[model samples]
Target: MKKVLVVILVAFIILQFFPIDKTNPAPTPGMDFLTIKKTPPETAEMIRTSCYDCHSNETAYPWYSNFAPASWFLKNHINEGRKHLNFSTFATYEPKRQLHKLEECIEMVGKKEMPLESYFVGHQDAKLTDEQRKLLIDYFKREKAETERKMSF
Candidate 1:
């Protein structure tokens, strides 16, 4: 038992050396979803607080992100999120893609699949209330409709 404990401690210490990269891509305000869509302040703040950490280029790594194994998991999750929908570069997506992304947003939020449960473990502030969830779903639905309408023209 003592030997096992010591090994675990040593492994943890070694893992600390392999810190995750915390660099965020440079901000592109002109291409950002919030800016281009002219999202209301309240809605924009909610989106930023609840989604931007993983979904946008403005990731603000928490203190624990300096640690290793957990940091690795976090980095991978963030990369996947950005790949699926990078609001920071939303304006660059073609109109069809933009509409699809907005549809995905509505579906995800409406189904309560977003703001992943594990995320609230570290960021309680990101947790959405029932009202907030409804607000976000409504906002996404509106955005999707607007995108579709514009594409028709």
Candidate 2:
């Protein structure tokens, strides 16, 4: 048991050497969804608190992100989230893609699948209340409608 414990401790220490890259991409405010869409302040704040960490270039890494295995998982998760939807570069996406992404936002928030449960473990403040979810859903719906309207012209 003692040997096993020693080995585990050593392995854990070794893992710390492989830190995840914490460099976030540079901000592009002109192209950001919040800026381009002119999202309401309240709704934008909610989105920033809950969604921006993973979904935007402005990731604010938490303390745990300094650790290894957890950091690796977090980096992978953030990369995947950005791949799916990068709000920092929202205006760069084609109009149809933007509309589709807004639709996705409505679906994800309405279904309460966003701000993943694991995220809440580290970020309690990021948790959305029922009212906040409704607000986000409504905001996304409105954005989608606006996008569609612009696409028609």
Cand. 2 Cα-lDDT: 0.94
State the weakest 10-residue window (summed lDDT) of model 1.
61-70
Report the C-alpha lDDT of model 2 over 1-153, residue by residue, as the tens digit.
999999999999999999999999989999999999998898899999999999999999999999889999999999999999999999999999998899999989888899899999989999999999998898888888888998899
lDDT per model vs. reference: 0.94, 0.94
In candidate 1, how many Å is residue 60 off?
0.8
Q: How does residue 114 of candidate 2 score in lDDT?
A: 97
Pairs in steric clash, model 1:
none
lDDT of 1 by residue, 1-153 (tens): 999999999999999988888889999999999999999999999999999999999999988898889899999999999999999999999999998899899888888899899999989999999999999989988888988899889
